[model samples]
Target: MTPDLVLYGYWRSSAAYRVRIALNLKGLAYESQPVHLVRDGGEQHGADYRALNPQELVPCLVDGGQVFTQSMAIIEYLDETRPTPPLLPADPAGRARVRALSQLVACDVHPLGNLRVLQHLVTQFHAEDAAKGVWSRHWIGEGFRALEAMLAGNVATGRFCHGDTPSMADACLAPQVYNAVRWKLPLDDFPTIQRIYAACQALEAFQQAAPEAQSDAPAAS
Candidate 1:
């Protein structure tokens, strides 16, 4: 069957993972087109994919004539277009809190540990692969420390990041937690994050969006 929606992404890309989770949560049917970030010198940089996204980023959503870039924007678009379940809160304060939690990881933590940045650290700065892993771990740990405090300290936090239901924050967070797991970053001190990760993973949406379940994921994951 021809897909109603299409997503371009690499298997393990955190940003792509976020979009997949959001699409799943919204019960939106979509097709996955893998853009191997490491193979053939990065398929996202190719002319064809570049035509779709000049930034060469993953998780570009194409629905008919419309094309959406950036994971957060696409997820928000989904939330706006499909309001049955509603990812954001109706209240302005609640929406702001959800967005802040989402940005805390997506902006503050993810940038320091993104794949391209890690590759650049090795290629440009002459850092070893181990050093690159350390860099990722360090930033993730720092961000989780703050996230832990925020989630644990706030009364607004519930089963998920914002409230009982999954929000944009949970969609943003689950992917970063996957990255942390891959890097073997310690989460002993961040019990709140650990609990949330466990809860999110239990859901079908998060499960189907996981890298191991993706069609393009490498064998023996």
Candidate 2:
């Protein structure tokens, strides 16, 4: 049986964007099924999407008679299955460093500023747009500060997050930086992140995965 790799995701979603970068890095061709996040009160929470992923998260990868959720997990699965273009490091220590960097953005910063969390801050906590922007900027700054310190103060820093070539950390960093720009956060503090972002943006893969280049992204850009 031929394997099916359909990504059910929204274009502007950072998590989904990360998976898109990984797929492009691996040079895999798959079906893109856009799941609108906000229209009709969150279609991701609809019964149909929930049937595929109970967690109701975007970027669900349907491959080889199995379903995979979580952006990091799906990306790692792709790296494992298609090892020609490796996403991790050859050494265990290097792999750990890359994963740590990626998680600092994905697990720590992303959850705090995700759509649902931000919406809750607005609707439940009565946070206005300015307050929400402050909230997003605060967490992004915190994560980027630590990430900059790690990158600038360590020898692991290279042309990309792990090396001269793009890696998982670079994929994670680009999307987070994009979100920070969206919320109007100043990038002057994180020189290393900005430098890495510039390098990643020069690549066709990252450029094509950008929110502005996607079909589902808003016209605000």
Candidate 3:
């Protein structure tokens, strides 16, 4: 069967990973259109893809002939259109909390460690891979410290980021945690985050959305 939805993304992009998790959680069928971010100076920069997303970023979703960019926006669109399994929450306060948590990672932390930012660090500032790793770890750790406090203190945080079911916050979190592990950041200080991440991983939605499980991911050694 042909899928009506198409997702253009790089396998390892955290932003793209968030969209993948959201799609899986919604039980939506989509075709993976891999855009190699590293090879050939990034296929995202190509004329065709840039037309779809002027920002030259991944996780561009095409649904019913309409194009959508930005991971968070796309997730919310899905939620609004589907609504069977809500990504936000029913109450206004809960919705705000989830969005705040999502942005804590997406806006505050993930941007510092983004591929383009790390590349600029190398080109403009002569940063080595070790320096980039350090940079990533520092920002991720700072964010996780705050995230841990928020999740730990909040009674709303249950098995997932909010209540028992996973929400947009969890969709945002799992990817950042993946980045933390990639940078070799220690998880000892974030027991709540670690626990929630473990819970997310046990779900089929997160399992299928993992970077390693993506079609564009390299073959296991």
Candidate 1 lDDT, tens digit per residue, 1-221?
A: 77779999888999999999998998888989999998888998999999999998797999986999998999889888888688999999999999999999989999899878988897889999899889999999999999999899999999999889999999999999989988999889999998999999999999999999999998987
Which portions of model 2 miss their true places by more than 4 Å? 1-3
Instruction: Compare the candidates by TM-score and give the number of the best one.
Output: 3
Question: Would you estimate the TM-scores of all the predictions?
Answer: 0.97, 0.96, 0.99
Q: Model-by-model lDDT, in order?
A: 0.91, 0.90, 0.96
Global Cα lDDT for candidate 2:
0.90
Q: Least lDDT summed over 10 consecutive residues: which range in candidate 2?
A: 1-10
> Best candidate per lDDT, number?
3
Worst 10 residues of 1 by lDDT: 1-10
> Root-mean-square deviation of each candidate, in angstroms?
1.0, 1.6, 0.7
Per-residue lDDT value at 103 in model 2: 98
Query: Where does candidate 1 clash, by residue pair?
Result: none
For candidate 2, what is the TM-score?
Answer: 0.96
List model 3 lDDT by residue over 1-221, tens digit each: 89889999988999999999999999999999999999999999999999999999988999989999999999999999989789999999999999999999999999999999999999999999999999999999999999999999999999999999999999999999999999999999999999999999999999999999999999981
